[model samples]
Target: MANFKKGVALVLAAATAFTFAPVANLAPVTASAAATQIADATDLNLVLGETKSIKIKDISAYSIQNYTVSSSNKNVAYVTTTTTTGAAVSADGATTGASLTFNYSQVGKTFDIYAAGNGTAVITLTANNTNGAVVTETFNVSVNDKIEHISVKKTSDNSELSTAKPLTIASTDIKATPAASIKTNVTATVANRAGTTLKAVSDDPTIVTVANGTGNTFDITPVKIGSTTVTVTDTDAQDKILASYTFAVTVARADETLKVTYDSNRDGKNEDYKADSTNGHSKQGNAVYLDDDKTSFQIVAESALGRKITYTSSNPNAVSVDNNGLVVVSDKVKQETTVQHISADISVKTEATKIGTTTVPAAEVVVPVHFVNKKYTTLSVADAEGNVIAQTVNSPVDLADTNKDSKIDASDDAVITLSTKDKTSVNLVVASNAGDNFVSGEVFAPATNGKIGTTKSDVVTYANGVLTVAKTDITTDTRAFLVLEAKPSTATYGANAKITLQILVTTKNANNVIDVAKTLDLNASTKTATIAAKATYGNILKYELVEADATQADGYKAVAGNSNTDLSVNASTGLVTYKSKNSGSQVVRITGTSNATAVAPKAAYVTVNYSVKKNASDLAVAAKSIILEEGKTAAIGATASTAITYVSSDESVATVAADGTVTAVKAGSAEITVKAASDDKFDEGVVTIPVVVSKKAENTVVPKPAKVTGVKVANVKGAKVKVSFKKVSKAAGY
Candidate 1:
């Protein structure tokens, strides 16, 4: 039945005995066989407002309507009856006093008794003959002032939490939470709680806090690392303790702890976390001997376990973290950037750790922190259009094709046509280190007789990072090795901060031609193509056809399907066209000679391959969306006649191997693109399917078993007792 529960139950002994759920075998009581006798019913103890049930074993012997149930104390308790024969339900529902009679009940059935008040109640079950009451059964019930019981359940899954004394809310049951604290929602069930509501408060709000919830539930949130007691009582009873609902709480900082580190380079590596030893002391990054004036940089917070990481600074006064973890230095810290650097501990959190059904307390570690001296953080320059090009202090950036005509050249007469004839010059912006004042600026270029950085150029000049080359300047090389010197003119910029920038300048109209096609893979439907060639002077060159052949001079042959008539070209215009005559591919060899003089590599050969394929019908990816748990695998499928390869848009979320086996790497959304490689029978095709990864689900709930229906008692002294229970739907067994 109920495995002998601690509460009340009915027992069968010759159709009359005391009953308790946990096998409390009280002595049997029977009525005289000649008179209308009472059947079994006992255990008359209850809480202030609780209900108990009992069954009638000898119900077959009498009609249910012949019995009238009543309580001697109308204000103490009441009785209600029901039948197993599916007869009209109890009319006792309408009568709330001490007694109730069934309007239509079958012979064999059960009835319920509810406690109405905290006092002694005498229940009388009288069986009537036609002449009036003939047999009477009296039960004395004791009603206690306490609630029947109390319980707590989870808000997420409705699963009951630990009901043991001093209940413990384990960390393994927590969900993902922020860095502040852990929050849990609890549901409590109690007896004698009809007109009252529960209110919960923490003894120390700095450690923990509780909010009143509807339906006797409470939300418990832990604030920090400390201990406190939560008292759940009626709102009016603020000082009065609730013996049944009070609990002790120990708080950690957050629900999900994590192992994290600082990555100064943002490369998902620990390049910054390593300590360097250098310059008479220790620790080295970039060499100042090479003019490494990089002073300010950004750092990224990373989780070592691939989970998302958060950031917090231990000493926010020196350097604080913004909402996205970018560093914001205070004025005091910025003033000391030259010799002092702020090295502070950063606290970081990761997503919750759950492997399959088991939850793990997040791992913690003191990650190695990177230390560096304060210097000028970065040096940036702007173009003629004021577009800033940011670079690290000592790195070099080439000025290729700056005029935007797709050529790089410098002529002997001056520079090239791009000499700054107008007032057009490339403007630059210098980021002075924090706490430093700027005065005046001048740029110097390399000269033949001067030192490397002390030289000056005859063609171009620079001041305050602005470099310009004029049409009247008589110089051939556009290369500008600029040294911005500290001059005495209290104008706009710099406090003797010597910064070096290597800018490779390119001018137009030089000696060589560029951009001759090595190979072409064009499948344009009309098959028209152009052999493009351009000179360093920023001009497209006209060409003459040198060779067009069907046979290979070298061992390389045309693709399997070609013939002599497949190619045609205009010798004057250098325009080519190909006519595909078969299902497979064909390759044609052609050589072009440019009219431009004095250029190297004159014999330029172009290889053009063409193919045609029929479209495959009914091509589609099998799944529109697939869901998988982390580390789980699934196969990719699509309808196609050609070979297929699967590609995941985000490999960190999911990975697809060459054989189309897709594996989930973490919990996120990704797309898998299925590509069908073309063959003679099918054209290339692609289909993308969305995939979602999730944590694995765990089973937790178990249903209660069947119920006790009847008990068969033997008349023989030594006979054993046989008990039967009602079969629960879908139950494997009792």
Candidate 2:
């Protein structure tokens, strides 16, 4: 029986070792040998009001007799245990009607650790094994406030406020005529603490007030015109003074009184009222010109805070006031026969007191206004020299209708047309001219509606009439008597007349005396010239053949050798042509006759002169041959009554210019020819000259020559004399 019992005990021991050893190898547990092993559990790190579950494991291969759970800081963190039977046990270690029971079946049980507040707590689990061994397990649990970040920002824009710098609220100007007020909202950001409320309080409520219970936002208003401080803190952590932000606020005082002024002219200057009892009108220092488009007066205030000014007009029909304190004279006042004086009241009130209970007195002033006529006149046309061009008794010059409307108006004042002679320019000037009631020192123009406009005038151009005549040379026979007759001679000449021609006898040669029996009448006004026709024995138009020389003294005949084929006589056209047979001057009388008897005919004569040229001869040159060195130029001496052309026979040796200057080309001889140009009075001639060019002399230094002691005359004849002198060595040729 002992052997059998020993065998059973050994088997039971092996079974226990095998069962518990595998469990221990699965998960390592730590505890005293006699105590129940507790599996290692992760520490709890949680936020406020958060819970974590820790699983309990037994690795000792022993049954758990009982278990108890407790927390070191119950207010910060709490612990509860659940047995394998599903019975819940609180930190005091009691279950529903009994104590917690634990064994191998409760190895997988769990203990729940809850975070009650922001602090650290240790949860201890004690379990006693059925073999009388006890094991304790502990876990550190941390509870943190849910807030992850904190910041302050403006509620309106959500802009973060700076913590490093004190927040400053802009001040208000309470002393201003109208006191200024300002307010703003600020909110705090508590991330992960969405339902938490923040509190904001001002250090000095007298200067600034912060409204509370407005969620995360607080309203900050300026209480008085001074400075104060405000602090914001988290209500949840009220005792944590380090987590608070303080800001500074300031309030400014504004001016107490507003200065108001009346600028009747709106020239930025105050005007004084002037009462005129006699005229039943009052003037505001200066007159408001009725001619100006802007005749309204303005009232201005000194302070922009209380700039609102009320303007009232006494006479609504004659004047009106606008919201901007501008007093405008009505059109009815402008159309009045006499000047009208207008009155207006301007008032401005000061700002309310600090408590908003009392009202400050307002400033009021009455301004008198006056209207005056701005006398102006129209524009007058003138020349560029400032000479006024107006209508006169003899000459009625009207202003130009520039628009072509056939009416003189304002648009025409800029430019005007004036009559001018050909090839001449006249400035059509326009200048300000005073009218019946002109105002001194005031400019006037047509476009200005009797107001000041252009101070200078512009110019316009007018073209002149051109005149031309049609006529050709006369070719006729010498024997025929040519009589010029004017066709359509009854025209006139003047500013509106056609151009006319006048003829007269300008010259008569010594040999001939032609008779003109009728008196020539040339009238420019009639555009006519006339010569009477003869009847019976009277010859009003006469042409007598005159001799050019004694050889043909009886009567000159046409020369057959004349090359002029256009010379002929046409008696029907009154055209005559004569070629002299001898070299002498002759005169012929030609009379012009008008087709109409009322038109006077003009008379004009012609004188014929001829000359005979000498026969051709050889051209002569001053020198037959010229000698020049290389690189030298000389003039070929030749003269003629007519123009002469020069030519070089050999340009390689020498060149001759048109003006007869000859340049030596090299050491050689050349022949230069001179020929006279064709002329009616001189015959053509030709001459030739020989030019010899020698080598240029070399430049060399020579000893000074002896000076001449005396000069003796060997022979003298008229202006020629032979002089002798002593010879010197190295002398240059003279």
Against the hidden reference, what TM-scores do the models get?
0.24, 0.19
What TM-score quantifies how close candidate 2 is to the native fold?
0.19
- Poorest 10 consecutive residues of model 2 by lDDT? 477-486
Error of 2 at 1 (Å): 99
Each model's lDDT: 0.46, 0.44
Off by over 4 Å in 2: 1-181, 185-198, 203-208, 212-217, 222-229, 234-239, 245-254, 257-370, 373-734
CA lDDT, candidate 1, residue 325: 50
lDDT of 1 by residue, 145-190 (tens): 3211112222221113222322223222343333233467765555
